[model samples]
Target: MSNFWKRAISGFLFVIILTGCIFLHPICFFVLFFIINIVGLYEFSKMARRMEIYINLPIYLFCGSLLFTAGFLDAYIGYRDGYLWCFLATFVMSIWELYRKKVNSFQNLAFSYYGLLYLSLPFTLLIYLPYMTSDEWRPEIVFFPFLLVWFNDTFAYLFGSRFGKHKLFPRISPKKSWEGAIGGGICTIGAALFIAPYLEGLTVYNNIIIACIVVFFGIYGDLLESMFKRNIEIKDSGSIMPGHGGVLDRFDAVLFVIPAIFVYLEFVY
Candidate 1:
C-alpha cells in the first residue's frame, strides 16, 4: 500500500483510540498515554544515540517511569508533591551520571533532560488535564486541546503547502511559513469560540482566551522541536509513524502547549 494509505489507517486507529478514551473513562486515556510515553522516550533516547550522544538509558527509563507515576498521582490526587519529586529524582539521576566517569558528557545528559521537558512533561500535562475535576466538562477539557492542535496542524500544512511564501524560521524549519501559522491560529481560535459554549460551564470569553493561548504556545512548541531536529541534522526524530515521522514530530506542539494550558486553567479557573 501507499504511504498515504498507511498513514490514513494509522491516524484513523489513533483517533479512534483517543475518542474511545474520552468517551470510556480517564483510566483508558491514561493507559494509552503511558504506553505512548514509553515508546516515545525510547525513540528519543535512540535518536540521541544516533547523534553520537549517549546517556545512561536505564537511568533515563527509571526517570521516565517516575514521571509517569507522579503524573498519574498529580492527576488524580491533586498531588503537588509529584512534580516536586519528579525534579528531585531527575536531579539525583543527573548527579549520579556525573559521578560515573565513564560518561562525562554534560551535553548528552543535558539533551536527555531536554527531551524529558519537551516530550514527557507536556504529555503528562495532557494526561493530567482531564482529571483536574469531577465535572462533566472533564471530557471536553481533555478532548478540545487535542482537537484544536490537530485542526491547527492540518490546516497549517494544507494552507502552507499551497501558498506559503514568508518563512517563519528558515534555519529551524524551512517549510514553515508565518502565513500558515497565522492562518492555522485563526482557524483554531475560531473553532474554540464556536465550541466553547458547549463546554459544561466555561464562559465563551474564557474559552476564547484559552484557545488563543493553546494556539500560540502550540506554534512555539512546534518551532522548538524543529530546532531540535535541526540541531541533530535529521529530517525527522524517528520513523515510527510513516508520514508523521516520529512521536516528537507528531507531538512537538502538544509538548509546549499542554503545560501552558494546564497553568492557564489553574490560574484562570
Candidate 2:
C-alpha cells in the first residue's frame, strides 16, 4: 500500500478507537489510555537506551504506570491517596540505584524520573480533563483539545509548506514558520466558535480561549518532542503506528496541550 493509504487507514483506526473508547464507557477510556501510557513509557525507555542513557527500566515503567493509574483512581473513584505510591517510588528509585552501581547514578535517576514527570504526568492530567467542567464523565469535554489540535496541525502544515518564509524555531524545527502558525491559529479559533455549541454548557468565549491555548501550547509540545528526537538523532519515537510513528509521536501536542487546558479550565470554572 502507498504511504498515504497506510496513514489514512491507521489514522482512521486511531480516531475511531479513541472516540469509541471515550464515548463507549469510562472504563473503556481508562483501559485504552492505560495501555497508551505503558506504550509511551516503553518507547521512551527504548530511546534512552539507544544513547547508552541507562535507566532502571523496570522501575521507570512501574512508576510511570503508577502515576497514570493513580490519577485514574483519583478521578474515577474520588480517592486521594492513589498518588502516595507514586511519591514513594522516587525514594525507592534512589535506593535501588545504590546496589547496581551504574555509571553516573545521578543522571540515571534524573532521566528515570524525567520520564515520569514529562510523559506520565501529562497523560494523568488528561484523565482529569472531563471532570474540569462537569462532575460526570463527559467524552465531549475530554475530546475538545483533540479537535482543535488536529485542526491547527493540518492547517499549519498546509500553510507552512506553501507560504512559509520565516522560521518559527530554526534550531529545532526549521520547517515551521510564523505564517503557518498564524494561519493555523486563525482556523482553529474559527473551529472553536463552531465547537462551542456542541459542548453543551461552555460559551463561545471560553471555547475561543481554549482554541488559543491549544494553538500556542500545542506548538510548544511539538517543538519539545522535536528537540528530544533531534537530541537523540532519531527520526521517529517508534514504529508502533506505521505511518503515524509511535503513540508519543502522534500525541506529543496532546500531552503538552492537556496540562495547559486542564489549568485553564480549572481557573476559569
Candidate 3:
C-alpha cells in the first residue's frame, strides 16, 4: 500500500477503536490503554537499550503495570490511597536494583523507573481526567482534549505547508514552522469554543485556555520524543503501525498534554 493510504487506514482505525473504547465503558478504556501502555513501555525500553543501558523488561513492565492498575482502581472505585501504592512500589524497585550486582545497575534502575514515570504515570493520570473534569463520569470530557489536539495538528500542517518560512526548531523538528504553530493554535482555540458548550464540564473560557495549553505542551511532547528518537538513531519509536510509527509516536503529545491539563483541571475543579 502507498504510504498515504497506509497512514489514512491505520489512523482511521485507531480513532475508531479509541473513540469506541472511551465511550463504550471504563473497563474497555482500561483494557485497551493497558495494552498500549505496555507496548509503549517496550518501545521506550528498546530505545534506552540502544544507549547501552541494561533494562529488565519484565520487572519494568510489572512496575509500570502496577502503577497503571492501581491508579485505575483508585479512579474507578473512588479510593484515595493510590499514591501510597506507587511510592511503595518505587521503594521496592530501588531496593531490588541494589542487589542485582550488574555493573552500573543504577542506570538500569533509573531507566526502569523512568519508564514507569514517563509512560505509566501519564496514562494513569489520563484515566483520572474524566473524574476530575466532570462532577460525574462523562466520556466527552475524556475525549475533549484529544479533539483539541487533532484540530491543532491538522490546521498546523495545512497552514505550515502553505505559508511556512521560518523554522520553529530546525535542530529538533525541521518541518515545523512558526506559521504552522500559530495557525494551529488559533484554530485550536476556535475548535475548543465550538465544542465547549457540548462538553458541559468546563466553560468556553476554560476550554480556550486548555486549547492553548494543548498546543504549547503538545509541541514540547512531540519534540522531546523526536530528540529521543534522534539520539537513538531511529525514525519511529516502533513499527506497530503501518504509517503512524508506534504507540509512543502516536501518544507522545498525549503523554505531556494530559498531565498539564490534569493540573489545570485540578486547580479549577
Query: What's each prediction's TM-score?
Result: 0.89, 0.96, 0.96
Considering summed lDDT, which 10 consecutive residues are worst modelled in model 1? 128-137
TM-score leaderboard ranking: 2, 3, 1
**What is the clash count of model 1?**
0
List of clashing residue pairs for candidate 1: none
lDDT (10s digit) by residue, model 3, range 1-269: 89999999999999999999999998998999899999999999999888888777777787788788888888888675766776787777778777777666878888888888789999998887887865456888888878888888899999999999999999999999999999999999999888887887688888988999999999999899999998888999999988989998999988899899989989998
User: Candidate 2: lDDT of 47?
Assistant: 82
Off-target runs (Cα >4 Å) in candidate 1 are 77-88, 131-137
Give candidate 2 regions above 4 Å deviation: none
Please write out the lDDT profile of model 1 over residues 83-149, one tens digit for every residue: 6777887888788776777553786788779768766877777766655444332777788888889
Worst 10 residues of 2 by lDDT: 45-54
> What TM-score number comes out for model 2?
0.96
What tens-digit string does per-residue lDDT give for candidate 2 at 1-269? 99999999999999999989988998998899889988988888888887777888888888888889899899989987879998898778888999977787777888888888778998899888888778888889888888899999999999998999999999999999999999999999999998788896577888998899999999999999999999989989998887889988999999889889888888887
Candidate 3, which segments miss by more than 4 Å at Cα? Answer: 80-83
